[model samples]
Target chain A: MIVLVDYKAGNLTSVQLALAEVGHESVISSDPSVISAADRLVFPGVGAAGSAMEEVNRLGLAPVLKDFVATGKPFLGICVGCQIILDWSLEDGRTACLGLIPGGTEIFTPGPGSKVPHMGWNHVGFYRPHPLFEGIPDRSHFYYVHSYYPTPSDHADVLAESDYAGVRFAAILGRKNLAAVQFHVEKSGAHGLRLLKNFCAWDGGC
Target chain B: MLTKRVIVCLDVRNGKVTKGVKFAGNVDLGDPVEMGAQYYRDGVDELVFYDIMASAEKRPIDIAMVRAVARKVFIPFSVGGGIRNLEDMREVLLAGAEKVSVNSLAVQNPDIISQGARAFGKQCIVLGMDAKRSDAPGLPSGYEVYVQGGRKAMGIDAVDWARRAVSLGAGEICVNSIDADGTKSGYELKLTRLIADAVEVPVIASGGAGTPAHLVDVFREGRADAGLVASMVHYGTYSLPSIKSALATAGIPVRSVP
Candidate 1:
C-alpha cells in the first residue's frame, strides 16, 4: 500500500483524487505503523514550511518519514513536501526542516519583471536519466506554485532543473530511496500522472 | 519557460452547467462534472466552477457538486461563490479542491483574505474580483468593484482593491469584467491591464473571451497570466485543442496535448 502522509497542515484530498485517477489505491494517514509498513510512500503538502513542519512534528511524522526513507522503499515528495525534506527553509523566517537532505530552501527573488509565487505551468529539464522520469519527455511542463524552492547543500542532488528569476532551481531531486518534485505532479495533467505511474512501478533502484 | 493557461469557467446553478449574460438570463447547458471531464480530456489547462447563485442567494456552496466534479476531474480545479468564511474554505478544500475563491466576502471583511492565506498558505487563496467600467467620481481606474455576483457596486476602485488584496496574501487574482461578460466581444483589456500591472501576483483575465485571438491579446497586451472562458467553450463555439493550437501557432507557449 502507498501511504500519503497527512500532517493536517493542508488538504490531501487532491493528491488522493489524482492517485485514484491514475488507478492507484492509497490511504491518507499520520499513523506511523501504517506508514512504516507501506511498500511505497508519498509525502505531499501545500502551504508554508513552518506550519507544515509544525504539524509533521506534532503528529511525530518526522522520524517515521526518516525511517521510511532508510528502509530503501520508494518515497516521493511534492511541492512543499519537497521543501521540508531539506535541512532548512527561509520561509516563515529561517525555519528548520527534516535535515534529511543536505541544503535548505530560499525565497525566490522578485526581479524587475518576474513574479513571486511563480504560479503557472513551467518546464522541467532533466539533468540525468532515472526511472522516475522514464516515459516523461525532457523539459516537459509541470504546474508550479511556490515562492520558496529547495537548494541542496550538494549540487549533485538536483536531478531536474527549471529556471525562474535568473535562478535554475531543482524541479526534481532524488537520493537513493527518496525522490521529490518542486512542482505539483498531481495537478500537472498527463505528464504528472505519468510521473506518478513511473514512481509506482519503480523498485527503489538507481 | 512557463506556458500561458486557458481556463474554462462553468457557472453552475443547481448542479447543472448554466451560462448567463452579465450574470443574468440563465441557460442550462449540461452537467458540470460531465462537461469538466470532457474538457479535461480535450486538454483544458484548468477549470473553475463558480456557483452563480450561491453568493446572491446567500447559501453555502454546493459541496456535493464540488465533490462530484473533483471526482471526475484530475487536474487542478478551483471552487468559488458563496464561500463565506474560513470554515467554508476549509470544507471545500477538504472536499478535494486545490483552491477556494473569496469574492464578496473579501470585500466585506478584508481580514478573511489574510486569515485564509495564513491558515491554508497563500497559494490556496484566490482573490476573485468582479469589476465594471464606471465614470463615478474618485474612481481612479474608472472601474468599480461589484459584489453579490455583480449585483452591487462597492464604489471602491477595482485597481486599489486588487493591490490591497495581494498585500494581504492573495497568491493569485482573477478579474472578471461585468460590462464585457457574455458579450462575446472580447475581454476588457484596459481593465485587465490595470490590475495585472498593479499587482505582482499572476492575474487571470476572466469574462468576454470569444475566440482564441482574445486569449493571445490578453497575454500579450493585457499581460494576463491566464484567460477564463465561460460561454465560448460551454456553448460549443470553440474546442480546447483548437484554442490551444491557435495559441501555439501564435507563438504563445502552451502545453502539448498528450
Candidate 2:
C-alpha cells in the first residue's frame, strides 16, 4: 500500500487523486504505525517550511519517515515535502529540516525581471537518468510554486536541475531509497501525470 | 525560463458554468466538471472557477462541485467566490482545489488574506480582484476595486489593493477587468500591466479574451504573467492548443501542448 504522509502542511487530496488517475491507490496517513506498514511513502506538501516542520514534529512523523526511507521500498517527496528533507531551510526564520539530504534550502534572490515567489511553469533539466524519470523527456516543463528550492551540497545527489531568477537550482534530488521533486507533478498536466505514474512504478534505483 | 500560464476561468452559477457581458445577462453553460475536464485534456495550464453568485448569497461555496471537478481534472485549479474565512479556504483545498481565491470577503475583511495565508501556505491563497476602469476621485491607475461580483465599486485603488494583498501574503493575483469581460474584443492591457508591474508575485490577466492574439497581446504588451480566458474557449471559439500556438508564435515563452 502507498501512504501519503499527512503533516497538515498542504492538501494531499490532489496527490491521492493523481495516484488514482495513474491506477495506483494510496492513503493519506500521519499515523506512525500505518506509515511504517505501508510499502511506499509519497511525501507531498506545500506551505511554510517552519510550520510544516512543526507539524511533522507535532505528529511525531520524523522518525517513522526516517525509518521508512531506510527500508528502500519506494519514497517520493514533492514541493515542501521535498525541501523539508534537506538539512536546513532559510525560510520561516531559519528552520532546521529533517537532514536526510546533504545541504540546506535558500531563498531565490534572482536579479531584476524575476518574480520573488518564482511561480509558474518552468523547465526541469535532468542531469542524470533515473527510473523515476523513465518516460519523461529531458527539459520538460513542470508547474512550480516556491520561493526557495533544495540546494544539495553533493552534486551527485542532484537528480534533475531547473532554473529561475537567473539561478539554476536542483529541481529533483535523490539519495538511497528516496526521491524528491521540487515541482507539483499532480499539477503539471499530462507530463506531471506521467512522472507520477513513473514514480508509482519506480524501484528507487538510478 | 518560467513560461507564462494560460488559465481558463469558469464562472459557475448553481453548479452550471455561466458567462455574461460585463457581469450581466448571464448565459448558462454546461457542467463545470465536464468543462473543466475538457479544458484540462485540451492543455490548459490551470483552471479557475468562480461561484458567480455565492458572495451576494452569503453562503459557503459548493464543496460538492469542487469535489466533482477535482475528480476529473488533474491539473492545478483555483476556486473563488463565496469564500468567507479560513475554514472555507481549508474546505476547498481539502476537497482537491490547489488554491482558494477570495474576492468580496477579501475586500470586506482584508485580514482574511493574511489569515488564509498563515493557515494555508501563501501559495494556496489567491487574491481575486475584480476591477473596473474608473476616473473616479481617489482611484489610482484610473481603476477602482469592485466586489459583490463587480456590482459594487469599493473606491479602493486596484493597484494599491494588489500591492497590499501581496504584502499581507497573497501568493498570486488574478486581475479581472469588468469592462473588458465578455466583450470578446481584448483584455484591459493598461490595468493588467499596472498591477503586474506593481506586485512581485505572478499576476494573471482575467476577462476579455476573444482570440489567441488577444492572449498574445496581454502576455506581451500587458506584461502579464498569465492570461485568464472565459468566453473564447467556453463558447467553442478557440481551443487551448490554438491559443498556446499563437502565444508561442509571438515569440513569448509558453508550454507546448503535450
Candidate 3:
C-alpha cells in the first residue's frame, strides 16, 4: 500500500483520487508508523514551506521520514513536499528543510516578459533515467503551481527540468529509491496518471 | 521552455455549466464535473471553476462540488467566487483546490491577499479582476474595475490596481474582460497586454475566446501566459486536442497529446 503523508497543509484528496484512478490503494495519514511500514511513501503539500515543516515537526514525522528514506523505500514528494526535502528554503526568509537532498529552495524571478508563480501547465524534460518517468514522454507537460524551486546539490539526482522566466530549473529529482517531481503529476492529466502508475509498479527493491 | 496554456473554464451555477454573453445573459450547458473531466482527458492544461452564484448567496465556495471535481480530476484546479477570507480559502484548499482566487473580497480587504499569501504561500493566492473600457478622460476606458461578477463597478484604474495586487502578494492575476466575455470574437488584446505589462505575475487573459486562433492571438500578440474560456469548450465549439494542435502549429509551444 502507498502511504500519503498528510500534514493538514492542503488537500490530499486529489492525490488520493489520482492514485485510485491509477488502480493503486493508498491511505492518507500523518502517522509515522504507517509511513514507515508502507511499500512506498508520498509526501504531498500545497502551502507555505515554514508552516508545512512545522506540521512535519509537530507530528514528529521528520525523523520517521528520515528513517524511511534511510531504509531505501520508494519515496515521492510533490510541490511543497518536494521543496521540503531540500536542505532549506528561502521563502519568507531562510528555513531548514528535510536535508534528504542537498541544496535549497529559492524564489523564482521571472525576467522581462516573464511571469512569477509559473502557474498553469508546462513541459517537463527528463534529464536522467528513473523508474518514476517510465511511461511519461520526455517534454510532457505537467500542471505546476509554485513560486519556489529546488536546486539539487548533486546534479546526478536531477531527473527533469522546466523553463520559466528564462531560467531552466530542476523539475524532477531522484537518487536510489527516492524520487520527486516539482510539478503536480496528480493533476497532469493522463500522462500524470501514467507517472503514478509507474511508481506503483516500480520494483526499485528499496 | 514553459509552454503557453489554453484553459477551458467552467462557470458553474446550480451544478450546471453556464455562460453569460458579455457577462449578461446566462445559458446552461451541461454537467460541470463531466465537462471538466472531458477537458482533462482531451489534453487541456488546467481548469478553473467559478461559482457564479456564490457572491449572491453570500456564502463560501461549494466545497462538496469542489470535492467531487477534485476527486475525478487530477490536474491542478483553482476555485474562485465568494472567497472572502482566510477561512473560506482554507476550506476550499482543504476540499482539494490547489489555488483559491479572490476578486471582490480581495478588493474589499486587500490585506486578505497578503494574509492568504502568508499562510498558504504566494503561489496559492490568485487575484481576479473584471475590467472594462471606460470613456472617461485622462484614464484608459477609465479601466474601471468591476465586482460581483461585473455587476458593480469600482472607479479604480485597472493598470494601477494590477500593480497594487502584485505588491500585495498576488502570485498571478486573471484579467477578465467584461466587454468581451462570451462574445466569441476574441480576447481583449489591448486590455490584456496592458495588465500583463503592468504586473510581473502570470496574467491569464479571460473572456471573449471563441476559436483556436483566438487563443493563439492572445498568447502570441497579447503575450498572456494563459487563456481562459468557458462557453466555447462547454458547448463543443472547440475541442481541447484541436486547440493544442492549432497552438502548436502557430509556433506557440504547447504540450502535445501523448
Across residues A1-206, which tens digit of lDDT does each residue of candidate 2 receive? 99999888867899988889899999888899999999889998898889989999999988998898888888999999989999898998889889888798989984556887888889889898788877888988999989998999999999899988878899999987788989998888888889889888887666
Candidate 1 regions with alpha-carbon error over 4 angstroms: none
TM-score of each model, in listed order: 0.98, 0.98, 0.94
User: Tens digit of lDDT per residue, candidate 2, span B143-253?
Assistant: 999988888888999999999999999999999999998899999999999998898888899888999888889988888889999889988888899988888888889
What are the clashing pairs of model 3? Answer: A187-B74, A187-B75, B134-B141
Best model per lDDT = 1
Q: For all the predictions, what are the DockQ values?
A: 0.78, 0.80, 0.70
RMSD, one per candidate, in order:
1.2, 1.2, 1.9
What would the per-residue lDDT of candidate 3 be over residues A1-206, giving only the tens digit for each residue?
89999898755878888899989879998888888898899898887888889889999989999999898778989988999999999875798989999988878887776676777778888887777777677888888888889898888878899988777888987878888889888888888899999888876542
**Cα deviation of B236 in candidate 2 (Å)?**
1.5
Worst 10 residues of 1 chain A by lDDT: A8-17
* lDDT tens readout by residue for model 1, B1-258: 778889899888988889988888998999988999999899888899998788778899999988888777767789999998899999998888888898989999999999999888888889999999999998999999999889899999999999999999998999999999999899999998999889889899998999999999999998898999878888788999999999999999897766
Docking class of 2: high
Ranked candidates, highest DockQ first: 2, 1, 3
How close to the true structure is residue A37 of candidate 3, measured as C-alpha lDDT?
92
- Which candidate number has the best DockQ? 2
Give the range where candidate 2 chain B is weakest over 10 consecutive residues by summed lDDT.
Answer: B51-60
